[model samples]
Target: MSGTELTVTLSGGSAADARAVVQALEPTFGAADERPGDDGATVHTATFEHEAADRPSDGASADAARLSAPVTVTVQGTPEAVEKASATLSRTFTTRDQGAASGDQEQERELLLEP
Candidate 1:
């Protein structure tokens, strides 16, 4: 299964909440390359190798769906993976644009997970 490399950045939430998000994403994206920011922010970056015709498993998807905190997430990937990730995450986290006029070149999207 050829997959695109992606990065997911998480910030603006408690450390525990941020960890939970990383835990949720691990099954699908594998172990994250974590970077803890100043204060209580954390970034979990990984690549997801999902089949072209498949969505992420419900179990793995729901891991993030269970969060009820306000955490911001940024995903960078191919258009398809970005869209799929946004939709999957929106099931539990509130999503919005990163306010970039054009995301075509960067292939990045950002979202805020509400508590």
Candidate 2:
């Protein structure tokens, strides 16, 4: 175990939907917290914790969900990788009027991104 932790909170997403998104990003040792049904938008939160990664210090995770506006994603990695991963995840995960419409798509998305 690397004894490392990464936490991220995102607004504008449904809890259920957000959960699905977090579930996609396989964290070494992390989980996603989603809060839905808030003024037509949803809120999603995700935490990444990996203690046994090859490079335990470089643990990273991404979470995203449907939103009234654009989806928000927060990623945390090692001090050095955090910034790069965060920027990439933020840009890649953030979306407007976009989301997975089917279970298969959602699953596929998760499989593609999760660690």
* Clashes per candidate, residues 3 or more apart or on different chains: 1, 4
Each model's C-alpha lDDT? 0.60, 0.40
Q: Which stretches of candidate 1 lie over 4 Å from their true place?
A: 27-57, 61-63, 66-68, 97-106
Which 10 consecutive positions of candidate 2 have the poorest summed lDDT? 104-113
User: How many times do residue backbones clash in model 2?
Assistant: 4
Task: Please report the TM-score between candidate 1 and the true structure.
Answer: 0.64
Ten-residue region with minimum lDDT total, candidate 1 = 52-61
lDDT of 1 by residue, 1-115 (tens): 5655656777766666676666665554555666343453355444555452343533454555555467888878776666656665665456665642236554677787776
lDDT of 2 at 87: 36
TM-scores, each model vs. reference: 0.64, 0.42
Q: lDDT by residue for model 2 over 1-115, one digit each (tens)?
A: 3454545455443555455445434433444333233345444555565542434323333334233343455544455334333433444345332222233211111112221
Question: Pick by TM-score: which candidate is best?
Answer: 1
Evaluated at residue 108, the lDDT of candidate 1 is 76
